[model samples]
Target: MLTHPTLNQLHALGLHGMAKAFVDIQASGDAASLGHAEWLALLLEREASLRHDKRLSARLRYAKLRQQACVEDIDYRTPRGLDRALFAQLAEGSWIDAHANLLICGPAGVGKSWLASALGNKACRDNRTVLYQRVPRLFSELALARGDGRHQRLLRALGRVDLLILDDWGLEPLDAAARHDLLEILEDRYGRRSTIVTSQLPVDQWHALIGDPTYADAVLDRLVHNAHRLELSGESLRRVRAQQAARTA
Candidate 1:
């Protein structure tokens, strides 16, 4: 019974999954058929699965993926010049294990952000922490952090994430403060954390986009040199989707 002291104890100990399984097994009268080892294994497996789902849910919530997207949802039929074999390799998440970065650069609307978000979602599903932030908004937050004296804390948090997706990179020009903040972030995350940068600008132009030559060198040094590149091409996927919708309509 829910009123039982043992059930209460299980709840108190935060073993809700096990407690629920116990109740279900008892109600189903499986205790007579299941050996002790079998019952124990069932309970433990339920608890483990529940815990994994909870962790994944928390990570996805914190990730702010915007589209609730996943890798399988990607539209490979759009002829985006994407390399299926290479993306297949990336889907395995070995790049993250190597602490390498990803550069997704292309014109607007080709699903750069979507691809990055898919990768981020995959990272979350794999039990790795991920954060998705647009570069412009992230810079604004960093500036605010500096004003509120939480700049270092923000950098530390970014450093701890298993994968960081900086979407909409090169959307705006970076001033001195933003340049410095970007450099600081890259420096902290360099060689230890993996990042996925989705930018409309090519990597070659990132230098001018960052403004200061020195900061550009430092930031790109930490980010670009060792990174894997995925340059999305062809017309924007949004246009393609819209055309498809119109035809259906």
Candidate 2:
């Protein structure tokens, strides 16, 4: 058993995970005990795991989440009106598989964006493609893309993602172009993809935010209908944390 030649062959064939596992098992003196079949199985498992990890890393990078949050780290004790059972069900990702929508509404600093990001993170972990964009910034980018000839391409990319997180929604009223763009984006995704929207304004106020009765009706029809709603309420978590820190200091 010439180990160097075998390792070189594995590396040359791009079996990096198996190659590293071989080295580790050889160093651990496990190679002498394990049969050839067992050794092959272990190597294959390591390679699959490595590939899965790489894919997850790429998905997370593509997600571009606004916060480093996870479902496991969610503060259930924070006195917000989060429904644990419903959220648990949501975390299983059935809603996403069904191409449904999630709406999270709360005042500023109430963790609306954070909760949305957590769901986005979970979707990435579940091997689903996700894209995170703040509504205002996304509209701005869409406007610029129109001038740069990337408008349709960008929309197509947005449409293709498995889950799209639109954070900070209704931060500013949409202008005519923005309103049209919103409808276009939503219409493209309607019943075909899942979307998570976080907003300071309630769903009732969304129509006014869009500014045009026609486009507003179209946008809300696509977004509000068949969407799961989570309305959070409490004092700002930021302020509470700052007060606690000051007292401790």
Candidate 3:
């Protein structure tokens, strides 16, 4: 019979999940039908599952995904010019472990951000720390961090995330400060963490967009060297979807 002392001990050891399972089993008298080994296994399994769930929830919360998209929920049927094989490979998350980056480029409203968010969501589910922020917003936040004298702190946070998704790249011009800030962020994560960038401009135009050849060289050197490029080609998905909806209505 399970007793109060046993439950208290389980809770003390930070096995609250198991402790609750034990209490439930005792109340139901279900443990009486199981052998000692089986009962212990059941308790341990419950504890493991509970911890896994809690950890995943925490990762997702911290991810701050813009679209709440998942790899499984991707609209592969929408003709967004994505390579299914490449996406399938990325879903395995091996590139993350290898410290590789992903560069996704496409026109506006073509699901570039959604794909990046989906990849980020998958990273969170894989128990990896992730952050999703627009490139403009990231620069703004960095500026604020500098104002508050927490610039290094913010950069460190960005550096330590297992996967960083920067959306809307090339949508806005970057000043000298923004370029240097971006370089610092990338320099910290280079060869240590993975990054996912979604840009409306082609890779060839990035240097010109950065507006500084030297900084562009330094930044792209770290990013493109060990990156997997996904050059998406398609029309505005939003417009197409709207047309389809109108026809249905």
lDDT of each: 0.88, 0.93, 0.91
- Over the stretch 66-114, how does candidate 2's per-residue lDDT look in tens digits? 9999999998999988899999989989999999999999888899988
Q: Could you tell me every candidate's TM-score relative to the true structure? A: 0.95, 0.98, 0.94
Tens digits of per-residue lDDT for model 3 on 1-249? 338889989999999889988988888988779999988898999999999999999998888898978899877887777999999999899999999999999889899888888888888888899988889988998988888999999899999999999989998899988999999989999999999999989899998998999999999999988999888887899999899999999
Candidate no. 2 TM-score: 0.98
TM-score of 1: 0.95
Instruction: Give the candidate order by descending TM-score.
Output: 2, 1, 3
- The best-first sequence of candidates by lDDT reads 2, 3, 1
Q: Top model by lDDT, which number?
A: 2
Which candidate would rank higher by lDDT, 1 or 3?
Answer: 3
Off by over 4 Å in 2: none
Error of 2 at 139 (Å): 0.7
What value of lDDT does candidate 1 attain over all alpha carbons? Answer: 0.88
lDDT per residue (tens digit) for residues 88-111 in model 1:
889899999999999998999988
